[model samples]
Target: MAKAAVLVASFLFVALTMFCEEATADYEGCCVSYSKYQLPFIRIKGYSIQTPNDYCDIPAVVFHTIKGRHICANPKDTWVEIRIQQLMNKVKKMA
Candidate 1:
C-alpha cells in the first residue's frame, strides 16, 4: 500500500510539472501584432517591458488593457514608448 501511494504521488508530480511547462511554453514568443483599433478600451491596466532573453531576443512592450487583453507592441515604436512613459507617470502620481 505504501509503495502504491508513492507511485501515485510520483506520477501526479510528473504530470503536474509537465502540464505547467506546457502552459508556460504557450506564452513563449507570444507577441501579437499591434492594432490601435482592435482594442476595446484605452485604459491600460498594466504594462511590462520584456528585454532580450534566452527564448525571445527582441524587446517588446506588453500592454495589459482594461478589458484583460495583452497587447504586445514594439519597444522601438515611438507611440509605444510615449504610451509607456504616460503610464509610468500615472503610476508615479498614484504612488
Candidate 2:
C-alpha cells in the first residue's frame, strides 16, 4: 500500500509539472498596448509607467501605426514590458 501511494504521488507531480509548462506561452521582451478614447498609453518593463511626454527606455516591438507612422500617445498611461535580451541587443547596437 505504501508503494502504491508513493507511485501515485509521483505520477501526479509529473503530470502537474507538464501541464503548467504547456499552459504558458513564451514571448520574449514583449509589451501589450491598448487605446482609450483616442489616447495612447504604454507600460515599459523594469520601469514604472509614465505619460507619453515622459521619455523612457524600452525594447522594440511592433505596434499599430497611424497614417503609416508610429506615434506614442497617452490616454491614461501605458504598460510596457521589455525583455532583457531585447534591451541588451539595443545597447549593443548603440555601442
Q: Which candidate number would show the highest lDDT if scored against the true structure? A: 1
lDDT of 2: 0.37
Give the per-residue Cα lDDT of candidate 1 at 28: 52
Q: Local distance difference test, per candidate?
A: 0.64, 0.37
How much is the lDDT of residue 64 in candidate 1? Answer: 82
**lDDT tens digits, residue span 1-95, model 2:** 99999999999999997764411111332223432222132222222223222233332333333333232323233332323344456668989
In model 1, the runs with Cα more than 4 Å from the true position are 1-29, 32-41
Stretches > 4 Å off in candidate 2:
22-95
Report RMSD (Å) for each prediction in the order shown.
Answer: 9.4, 14.4
Residue 49 of model 1 has an lDDT of: 68
Could you tally the backbone clashes for each prediction?
0, 10
Q: What root-mean-square deviation over C-alphas does model 1 reach?
A: 9.4
TM-score of 2: 0.27
